[model samples]
Target chain A: MANFLGLIQNENMKIYRRNSAKVFAAILIGLLLLGALIVKLNAPEHPTQDTHWKQSLQQQNTQYQQALTQMKDNDSYQNYYKSQIAINQYRIDHNIAPDRQMTLWSFVENATPIMILVISIFTIIVVANSIASEFNTGTVKLLMIRPISRTEILLSKYVSSLLFSLLCLVVLFLFSWLIGGLFFGFSGGEAHLSYINGAVHETSWVLATWQNYLLDAVKLIMMVTLAGVIAALFRNGGLAIGLTIFLMMGSNTILALISQYDWVKYVLFTNMDLNQYFNGQQTRNDMSLGFSLIVLAVYYVVFLGAGWLFYTKRDIKA
Target chain B: MGINTEPQKQPAVKLEHVTKKFGSKTVIDDLSFEIYGGEVFGFLGPNGAGKTTTIRMIVGLMRMTKGNIFIQGHSVKSEFKQAMRQVGAIVENPEMYKFLTGYQNLVHYARMIPGISKERIMEVVKLVDLEDRIHEKVKKYSLGMRQRLGVAQALLHHPSVLILDEPTNGLDPQGIHDLRNYLHELSRKEGVAVVVSSHLLSEMQLMCDRIGIIKKGKLIGVETVSDFMGEGEGKVRFTVDDGQSAAQIVKQKLSLDAASIESDAIELAIEHEKIPVVVDTLVVSQVKIYGVVSVTQSLEDRFLEVTGGKSVG
Candidate 1:
C-alpha cells in the first residue's frame, strides 16, 4: 500500500511538473475571476429588494396552480409545476422569502455550469496526455523496466488524472466562494430549500452546492475516463484528446438525436448527467437514478478494464 | 541455471529458448544465452536481428511467445518484481522526460521502488558526473549528458544485472571511454553482469569480456573475447624465390596439401612455431626464402566472415 502511494506521488510529480498543467490551473482561476468581474460590473450596485416577496410568491403559486389545472391531461410533464407550487407554498408557510439579491452561494451557483465546462476540457487533456506522452517520448521503455508492475503504474496514472480533476473542482468551488463573497455581500444564510417527496426541506447550501457541482460533473468523469483509456490503448495523445473533446462537445446533439430510440438509455451520454433525476427531469421514462447509476458503473468498468488489460498485457515496443 | 552455491558462479541473467512472434512472423526465434556476473557481455548483431526485442523481453517490457527468462534466480514471468529488482536497463535510448530536470527524472524513477533515498539519488548523480547540471531540464541537456543521466537512473536501485542497448549511441570518444571504464569497474568490483549491445566492432572488442554474435534471431556463436577472434590465427605467407618449388618442398615435408604459390609467394595456414620449420625445410631443399609474415585476422574480418559479410548496424 505504501508502494502504491509512492507510485501515485511519482505520477503526481510528472503531472504537476509540466507547464501545461499549471497553465490549465491558471486558466480556471482566470475564468472564475472574469465571471465574477462580469457579474459585478453588470449589476446595479444599489438595487432595492422587493419587500413583498411573500405576496409575489403567493401570486406565482396561484398562477402555477392554474397552469397545473389546465394541463391536467398532460400528467407526465406535471412534476415541474408541482415542484414549484410545493416550494412556494412551503416558503409562504415557513415565512422564508425567495432571494431577490445576489448572494455568495447564489453567485457560485451561477458560475458552476460554465466553469465546469472549462474544467472538464482541461482535465480531459491532462488525462489523455498522461498515458500517451510516455509512449511518444519513448520513456515508457524505461518506465516499464522498473521493479513496479505495469498494473500499478497504470493505476497510478489513472488515479492522478482524477486527482488533478478533483483538485480543479475543489479550487473552483473555493475560489468561486471567495470571489462571490467579495463581489456580492455574504448577507444571506447558507440555507437551500428543496422539494422532495412532496415536502420542502431546508439543507446546508455547502452540501447542496457540492452535490450540485459533483452531479453536474458526471459527464466530466465519463469523458476523462474515456480519454485516458483511448490514450492508453492507442498510445496517441492528440488522437485521444481530439476524439474525447469532439464527443464531449457533441454529446448533447448526439443524445438528442438518439433519445427517440428505445436503447438510448443504455448509451453512455444518456446516463452521464446523473443530475437529471435530482432536478425532476428524465430523458426517458425508464431511466431512474438507479438505472443511470448502473449504466455508468458498467461503462466505468469496461473503460478501465480494457485499459488495464492492454496496458499490462500488450507489448510496449515504443 | 542462475542458481549456484557460489555467489559469482551462476549467471545473473538466463534466457531459456525465448521466442517472440507478431502474428505469424517470428521476431525472436528460439534464442537462448546466459550472462554471468563480473563480466561485460556484448550482444553483437546486425540491424533487425532481434537484439532490441530480446532486451525488451528480458526486461519484462514485452512478453515472450514461448519460454522463460530468469534474473538472479527469479522468473520474469511469475516473480516479475523480484526479477526486475535485480535488473536495470536502457532498452534503446536514454529517453528521459524532457520537461523534467535530471534530478526530478531520477526522483521519478526512484519513487517507483522502495528504500531509495535522496542521498542515493545524489550518489548516482555524482557517479555519472552530472552534479553540475543535475538540476537542469533534460531538454537542455546534450545527448552525452542524457546518456549519463540515463546511466544514473538505471544504477539508482543497485541492480545485479545491468543491460544497456547501444549505450554508446550518442556518446563522444571521451564519454564512451569513461563509460567503458565505469562498466568494467561495476562488473569487476560489484559482480554486476553488464550486458552491452552495439554495432561498433572495435568498441565491442575493447569493452567486452565475452561476446554473443546473433544473426536473423538465432545466435550464431557465443565466445570469449579471445576465442571469438579465432585465437589470432591467419595464413603465414612466405615471399620466396622459386615459390612453386618452395611450396612443393613445404607440401612434401609438412603435409600442407592446401598450401599453394600465388604472386611469387607461398602461403601456409600454420602456427608461429612452424614458420621456423618451414624455413629450415626450404633452406635444406635449396629453395630461396626472402620474407615470412603472418597476416592475422581482426575481429572485423572474423565477424564479417562469420556473418556472411552483412555489415553490422
Candidate 2:
C-alpha cells in the first residue's frame, strides 16, 4: 500500500538525514578502498609464476599434510587441513587451475565476514537507536498520534534498518569489486573448487559468493532484530547498542566455552554462523544446516514478536 | 462568536467515562466530556491532575482502562484509525525529528495520511507563517518556531479535532498572541474543535470559549469562560466622596458584611442582583457615589476555589 511505503520512506529519511549516518557511510567506503589498496600492494606481481596445476596442488598438499601432522590433536586444525588437502587433490586430479591470481572476486569472497561484521555493527547501532531515540527525545507520541497503527510504525522502522544494512552490504560489495578490479585485475574464472560431501566439487563462483553473502545476511538479520527488540523493550538507545554489541562481539567466545554442553547448540549465537554450513563446517558435531535454520527461524519470530508486542501494547507515556 | 452554529450536530470529540489506570494507580478516573465543533475548549488542571493523561487517551497514545473516546462518531477503541484520522494532537510537547528540516518533517507526517496534497502542505505552512524557514532543519529552529511548525503539521490533514497539550509552554508574548489568534481562527472559521490544556490561566481566559477544570483525576467543572469566572457573588466596589460613610451605609442598608474602606473606595461582596439596591441606597443616602463597578472573580481565583486551592501547574 502507498501508506506503508510512505511510512518506510519517512523512516528512511529520518535515518539518512542524520549527519552521523552520512559520516559512517563515508568511513565504511573509505575503509574498503584502503583495504583494497593494502591487498593490492601486498600481492605478488606474478603469483602463478612457473607453476602449473599439478605442481602447485602437490606443493599445497605437502604443506597441508605437514601442518596436519603437527596439529593432529587439534580437531579444528586437522579438519581444516584435511579439507584443504582434499580440495587440492581434487583440483590436481581434474587438471583444474589453483586460482593463483588474487582476483576481485576472490578478495570479495575473502572479505565477506569483514563486510558482514561492519554492516552488523552499523545495523545494530541504527536499529537500536531507531525506536529508543524516539522515546528518549519524546517523539514517539508524534508518531503514535497519527492514523497508522503502532505495528505499522515499528515495522517501518525495522524495514528501514534492514534496508540500511542491505544498502551497506551492496555498497561494500560494489566498492570492493571496483577497487579490487582496479588493483588486482579481474582475472579469475567463474568456477571455484569447494570441498563438499567429503570431496572437492566445482561450484559456480557467483553462486557460492552470493550464498556466502546471503548467509552473512542471516547474522545481520538476527542481530538487527535483537537490537530492535532491545530498543523497544529498554527504550534506551545507549543501553541497547552497548548490550547488543557486547553480545555480538562475545558470541563466538561464549559459544566456544559452552560447546561441550549439548544445549549450547540451541543457543542463537551458535546457530547464527550460517557461513559454517556453507563451508561444510559444523559449529557443533550435532548441529546441521536444517537445525540451524530452524533455530534462526524461531529466534527471528520471537524477536519480531517481542518487538511488536512491546511497541504496540506498552504505553507511550513519555 | 457562536460556540456551535449547529446545535443539533454531533460532538467533534466525545469521551465516555474514560478511565486510565497505571499499575494500581488511577491517573484518570471516569472522566467524561464532549467538545463540539467550532469551539476552543480549554483543559485546565493542576499538576498531576490527569490533563495530559486524558489527552493521550483521546489521541490514542494511551489506552483507557474503562471507557471509549469517539472522534466524530468513530470509537477510538474499536476504530482507532478512523477515529485518529479525524484528530490531530500534540501531547505534552511538540518534539519533532530535530535532524530533519521543517518541511521534511511535515512531508514525513503527511505520508501517513491519505489524500494530503503538496498544496495543502504549503497552505498549512503559510497558515503557520513558517514559509520562509520551513526548509531549515528543526535543530536550528527556536522553541516558538518549532511549536508553530508543530501546529502546521497537526493542521495539514484538516482534522475535525485539534488537541494541543501545553502548546504555549515556551513562547514569547508575540508568539503566544499569534498562536492564540491562529487557534481562535481555526476553531471559528474552520469549525475545528480545538482542545488546549495549559497552566497559563490568563492565556486560557483570553483564548478558550469554554473550559474544563480537573483536579486529582476528576472533572471538577466545565463552563463558558464568563460563567466559570462569575460562579459566585462578585465584589462591588463603590468609589465615592467618603469611603468610611459609604462602607457604613452599605453594611447597614444591604445587610452585607462590613465593606473594606480604602481611601475613597468601599468594596463589598454582594450578589449581582443586589447591585441596583446598593446603588439606590447610596443615592437615597446622598453618598455622592462617583462610580459603582462589579468585579467578577478571575479564572485563577475561581479555579483555586473549585479545585480546593490546588495551584494549576
Would you estimate the TM-scores of all the predictions? 0.91, 0.91
In model 1 chain A, the worst 10-residue window by lDDT is A71-80
Which residue ranges in model 2 land beyond 4 Å of their true spot? A44-79, A97-101, A188-190, B1-7, B237-253, B258-267, B271-293
Q: What is the TM-score of chain A alone in each candidate?
A: 0.91, 0.91
| Per-residue accuracy of model 2 over B88-186 as CA lDDT, tens digit each | 888887999999999999998999999999999999999888999999989999988998888888888998899998888778898899899988888
Q: Per-residue lDDT of A152-254 in model 2, one digit per residue for the tens?
A: 9998999999999888878877887777788777775557777765777788777777788788899889988998999899899899889988999998888
Task: Output the lDDT of residue A42, model 2.
Answer: 86
Model 1 DockQ (Cα-based): 0.78
Q: Highest lDDT, which number?
A: 1
- Candidate 1 wrong stretches, greater than 4 Å: A45-78, A88-97, B1-9, B237-267, B276-292
Candidate 2 DockQ, CA atoms: 0.82
lDDT per residue for candidate 1 within B1-313, as digits (tens), equals: 2221133656799999999999999888888889898889999888888888899999998899998999998999999999999998988989999998999999988988889999999999998899999999999999989999988988999999999988998899988999999998888888889999998889999999888988898898889888877665768988887777877777788888535577579888887788888888888998877888887778888888888899777
